[model samples]
Target chain A: MNQAGYSEETMTNVRAEKVREVARLATRTGRARSGEFLAEGPQSVREAMALHLHNAGHGGQPVVRALYATEECLDRYPEFEEMAAKASGVRTRLVSAEVLSAMADTVTPQGIVATCLIPETSLEAVAGLNPRLVAVLCRVQDPGNAGTILRAAAAAGADAVVFTSGSVDIYNPKAVRSTVGSIFHLPVITNADFGHTITTLKAQGCTVLAADGYGAADLDVLQDDSAARRNENQDKAMLEEPRLESPTVWLFGNEGQGLEEAEMARADHRVAVPLYGKVESLNVGTAATVCLYASARAQRRNCT
Target chain B: MNQAGYSEETMTNVRAEKVREVARLATRTGRARSGEFLAEGPQSVREAMALHLHNAGHGGQPVVRALYATEECLDRYPEFEEMAAKASGVRTRLVSAEVLSAMADTVTPQGIVATCLIPETSLEAVAGLNPRLVAVLCRVQDPGNAGTILRAAAAAGADAVVFTSGSVDIYNPKAVRSTVGSIFHLPVITNADFGHTITTLKAQGCTVLAADGYGAADLDVLQDDSAARRNENQDKAMLEEPRLESPTVWLFGNEGQGLEEAEMARADHRVAVPLYGKVESLNVGTAATVCLYASARAQRRNCT
Candidate 1:
């Protein structure tokens, strides 16, 4: 093989104990016991490597514990090769297609997978940073929804994302895949007490906004009012009011039952994304994205 | 039985011909042959029923062809009773849990499923309505992404949603499920020629905007400029410019590969949803929702 650092050796045994252990990371109990998660597909593996490189000098531990890739995947995707070269600390192992399949949770693993230490962030650390925008997912069970929300938060420039204890495990392969590499972009705090997280954010001068379908404050009206205020003045104090544009933490709830009354009450305001048509409401993922972007746009305007 | 009009029948055999026929609608070929689709779970069934009732007098066909529910499901959900009462035209049948399971595509079928006629809308019909906002899904393959886009468009007050022929089947069960009952909210046109759709939309005085990651136009800047223009004047002509606030159709492409070059050329503007953080870009669903809502907000302000 002409490729440098590409292992010529191949693991052909699909039933090997090592391959089974890697596949077990797909389950919550397996992940808890191993303290590692699988980052499958080229996008996820690439991003994980990039984050490892970026955090190298910040006292962050090596995230990419090992990489398993097929020879064809390495040849077809040059980016994977580049990522492997960048993360020299990660152990690379060439595997057969069957071996890769045995280690992947998905029907098709895209020829690349990585074993990574589960990333952790503390709520107090997130709150201490005084983040201008944060996303809180409370009891959100769908891994896809949870991952997409994290992705949305990152794109919307949220400083952090905190998932309550009742939420899905962030390291779940399905959730990690849905993030589409955004999981490596910012701080994601998991398994935090919902009430304490909200209180901490509030103490950090953040206005906690609960997203609910039956909430009193309409999102459109809130945006309109904020736009009006922005048009009136560019003063820093005026722009920093505890409204949609201010330092905000958006609380999103579960797929089936949304935020309970107690959860909604923990927030400073309950905001509803208005439905102009007959559609009853937005899904948690779409609603969270809109709310995050609204704050992103407002905060950017305030800065200008 | 105390329940009025409730059938005291149960279908215990999962391999019954009726069960097999209902399960077939989960596939494209099955839906094509039967001219019907499955609306699974309570949310989808309820919305399908409401839309059926709403369109009853408008020369629309009977939408609900048949209803399959387990006895336990009917006993637990009173809304099912209400829907049954409202939809007297629908053939209601009681089935065993196993029979219902055999007929559902989801892992958990939520106890109720309805076979509904495929709702059809012509592009000409959509164009003739002079819709202020429409969402065009061009070759978007992900069923969940396609359905979420439909849901977002309806929530954003779009008059219609058009899916190009290359896109996933609108009747795909996952897409229908992801719509969360929003599928029946408005006119959804599928299998339309992409170029013809754009030209027709343009001829209707609608501005065609293609969402691209590499586009020159920034969404936030566009929103800010439109907001400024709206603050300056409320004149009808001023509001009708080819801007974010004007009559607009947002073109979103596939999950992996966005809009092609030729497709981008068809739009009046190619807008990029700004990424404030290190995240490479937004998913098609989140990006489309933000774009649709931006236009929704701008147009609503213009009207005021």
Candidate 2:
């Protein structure tokens, strides 16, 4: 074993105990047992290394448990080599392509895989940011949808993303891949208590809105009203409406059933994205993107 | 043969010539040769049937050449039976689950499949709509992205969607599946001439905007500027910005490489959605959703 306690000789056995241990992280139970999940492909691994280096530089807990890469990948992307060497306590090892593939969930691992510690975050951590915009996923099932929304939340500059207890695991390998490295750019809280999460964010001056298709209020109207108010058009009647310009928490629901009656009831208002055509409903990711960006846009008038 | 030229008896043979013909529609060459494409599952077939019935009633060319469903599916979704019988020349037949499985591209066909006429649309058809918003995909390689964008465009009330010559076939089975029945909701032009498409739309008084990450203009700024103009803020120096409220065509490029330099040059402005965080860029579908919805919201103040 090297200083970081990984094999010195390149891992050549596809069925080695260490390889099997890494492969096991693909499963939920395996992840729970090991407290780690796999991040495959160069893009994901590159971001993982950046986070590891950042944590190492700061006095934060290191995120990478073990990183396995093929020689060809190291040759192609030299930055990974430089970052790995700089990040302390990361178990880095060179492995053959076959060994890396066996340890990855994707058919093509693209020559790199990392076992990363599952992040733990609390509502205090999120509220500490004094977030202007936040996204909450309540029972959103698909891993891809969760990842897509997380990535969108990050891109739209949401302070944090919270997934309710029944929602898909953001640390799932496929979900991590779907993030395309945006997973490292923002804070994410998984398996959160749905009711308490909302109430807490609300206490911190966040307007909690549920994204519902059958809602009475149209999102465009609210946006227009917000703009009109921002322009100092004092209509006054619509002043009681939920303000998009304020700090906000958007609750997105499952793909098929949408928000439960209880879920909708929990929100200050059930907001719907305008469907100008005959679409039954907007895909959750698309709806979330429009909603989060609306808040981002409404809140950024001063900054822009 | 029945009135529609298919056997009246139920199709039970999984390997029959007719089954092979239907299965072949999953491929591009087969779709081109037969001028038919397969739409699997009930939601998609339901939409196809609605279009077929509408066309048949209007003396337009009937869209569905054949409709196949398992007995269990028919019992579950009786609307298919009712619509199939109503549409003239629909050659509906009940197939066993095994036979339906053999005919579908998806692992689970969810009980119905339709082989429909390949829609042929032109610049004239789109121009005739007096469109205010249009989405143009230029060499966008992913079928899922193409389909998702189409669905988003339709939902955003885009008048039509245009696929440049090298882009994915909107009629491809995977692409059609991704549309989730939105494929039948709006006019789509495939294999379009990129340069001519931009020029013609421009000639028709449409502003063409290329969505580029490295764009000179920020979309949020333009949106803010448009709102300011609407509020009658006469800052005459800022009048030169592209207006998002005007009738416009948005050109989105490939998944890997965005719009080419020449393609960007063909547009009135290369507009970038403001990236609020550290994400390198937005996913094409996410970007398209934001851009189209921005245009839709800007253009709809008068209507809503």
TM-scores of all candidate predictions against the true structure = 0.95, 0.94
**What DockQ does candidate 1 score?**
0.80
Q: Which stretches of candidate 2 lie over 4 Å from their true place?
A: A1-7, A233-238, A302-304, B1-7, B233-238, B302-304
Identify the candidate with maximal TM-score: 1
Off by over 4 Å in 1: A1-8, A82-86, A236-241, B1-8, B82-88, B236-241
Q: Which tens-of-lDDT digit does each residue in B224-303 have in candidate 2?
A: 76766666644453566588888999999998898999999899898999999888888899999999998988787633
Per-residue lDDT over B36-84 for candidate 1, one digit per residue giving the tens place of the 0 to 100 score: 9999998899888877777775768678888898878887887777877
Model 1 chain B weakest 10-residue run by lDDT: B233-242
Residue B11's lDDT within candidate 1 is 79
Summed backbone clashes in each candidate are 0, 0
Worst 10 residues of 2 chain A by lDDT: A1-10
Tens-place lDDT per residue, model 2, A1-304, is: 2433344889899999999999998899999999998889888888888888888878876788888988888879878777777775788899998898889999999999889998777988888888889999999998888888888999999999999999998888889988998998888898899888988898898888999998877888777767777677444435657888889999999988898999889899989999988888888999999999988888886334
Query: Local error of candidate 2 at A105, Å?
Result: 2.1
lDDT per residue for candidate 1 within A1-304, as digits (tens), equals: 5455566568899999999999999999999998899999988888898878777857686788899999899888878778777677877888999999999998889999999988766888887787999999999999989999999999999999998998999889999999988888888888989878888888898898999999888887777667767788756335433478889999999988999889998888888998877888789998998899989988887656
Clashing pairs in 2: none
